[model samples]
Target: MDLENQLKNLFPDHVSEKVSEKKDSEEKGIWLQDDPIICKYEKRKGKPITILEGYTGATEDFKKLAKELKQKLSVGGSFKDDKIIIQGDYRDKIMQILKDKGFAVKRVGG
Candidate 1:
């Protein structure tokens, strides 16, 4: 017998709640801001890094966006000092991603 069938037989008086397969908004959805987020490129420790800042949304939303960007780019990054520092100068890729997500991005520092 299936596990659910056995459980029903053993606990006839018990009610089981249906599980929902909905994703959390914190990870799936973020608050989109009107102002353009700044995307800049800089050299640190002889390596290139892309920085994104000027997000007026909640910290959680920014963090979520940071996580998504890192995952999409398959690169390492960190959310520090209210900014997203992604390894390598992926300004084009990052801007495209943010724009696809309905965010305005401003390219800075070439």
Candidate 2:
């Protein structure tokens, strides 16, 4: 006779719809695109940095990807102007990670 009982009493004729578990399990909340994401290395202020771009998705999704990459690589980074700027050179690792996550990655420059 808790919340469930109270709800049933309030709406005896109401039918509760069951949520689809398969759909929820399938969606990662990120959009997958055909074009490959560009991963490039650069030097700003004489410090090496990795930049990821060309993601044709929502900003929030890109931010989430940025956060995940930083955590996985255990490095500092930021999301700016539709791009992810990660500290240090981690092109190979980043590309492998993206590929494993069903993303196509293109490495640019040395």
Candidate 3:
């Protein structure tokens, strides 16, 4: 017997729910929130690094944002501890990018 037939026989009166399909991809969609995403800078080992925090989205979404930022800036970076760490200090540029994507960005520190 086919798997579907066996399942029907076992459940007897089970009704499978219909699944919905989304034609759009969420990755192509940028999520906007009320609170601004915190953009800050600090020197690590005498080198400047930009850090972005306070993003209350799925980790996958944050990682996608980080990848887009790195590609746009052509810089190396990583997502660690639920924060994004990008090489060098590109606070102004990064903030602009986020703003264009409909995310409120707040500059914090030098």
Candidate 4:
């Protein structure tokens, strides 16, 4: 099954459904929350970086996600402050990843 289908199946609830729709609507952004989950990208020292913040995600799950993203992007990254930071300009990549993971993402800045 496709990623969207998988997410739907994994989270078959109203909240998940609403989030899924929102993610679909917002294609170039990060999904963030104060204490829940936040995903965004930033430019540091002329380098593009993706930061996944406010993630109260489990250790194992966070590690798994980080590993997957690093592998996919072929870059160095880490999980800190309950967030994921990937090296390079990964706005597009991170956006897609979060969308697949069922998070509503919004891109801020050029």
Candidate 5:
């Protein structure tokens, strides 16, 4: 028997709550701020990198945003010093994404 069935057999009177799937209309827990997030491009070690910073929200929220951005862009990245450092120069794409998510974004450096 599966674990669920065994658990049910062990506690017939116990009730289990159904897991809820995230709905599109649900708000992401990240805090919104009036200040525009800064998106910039830089060459570090002769490789192009995109950096996003200036978020005033909780650190965990920023980390989650970084992870989401990396997944959507299909690239490697890191979150450090309150900045999201992406592997490529994706300023336009990243700005669009932040705008779609209701965050103001400012692009810096060509």
Candidate 6:
């Protein structure tokens, strides 16, 4: 039997139409908050740090993205609380990377 017919027979009650509709909504766009990106230098226990905030993204994808960014910038970084923290000041660099990745990004505080 054809794949479509076989699937229909397997789930007689549930159909593919409902699944398609839900998939359409999810493909619209990556939902991003209207908040400015914030970058700042911080000191933690006498160690210098750089923090980036105002980001909303899925944890797994966020980590993957962070990994790529760190590699690109040739710096060390980590993801925590839905935020990306890269060593040193890399606001412009990170902004450019996100833009290149087709993300609607805006730089906020210095």
Number of the top-ranking candidate, with TM-score as the measure: 5
What lDDT tens digits, residue by residue, belong to model 2 across residues 41-78? 99999999999999998898899889989998999999
Clash totals in order: 0, 0, 0, 9, 0, 0
Question: Over the stretch 1-110, how does candidate 5's per-residue lDDT look in tens digits?
Answer: 89999999999999999876653433467788999999999999999999999999899889988988999999999999999999988998999988999999998988
lDDT of 3 at 15: 89
Worst 10 residues of 6 by lDDT: 22-31
lDDT of 4 by residue, 1-110 (tens): 88878877888783443345643443333333335345566888988787876555456666766777899889998878777889987878777876776666656566
- List the global CA lDDT of all models: 0.90, 0.91, 0.89, 0.69, 0.91, 0.69
Select the stronger candidate by TM-score from 2 and 4.
2
Cα-based TM-score, every candidate: 0.76, 0.76, 0.74, 0.56, 0.78, 0.56
Ranking by lDDT: 2, 5, 1, 3, 6, 4
RMSD of 4: 11.9
Candidate 4: misplaced stretches above 4 Å? 1-37
Candidate 1 has its poorest 10 consecutive residues by lDDT at 20-29
With candidate 1 superimposed using the best TM-score fit, by how many Å does residue 7's alpha carbon deviate from the native?
Answer: 15
What alpha-carbon RMSD in Å does predicted model 1 have with respect to the real structure? 3.2
- Judged by lDDT, which candidate is best? 2
Scored by Cα lDDT, where does model 4 land?
0.69
lDDT of 2: 0.91
lDDT, model 2, position 8? 84
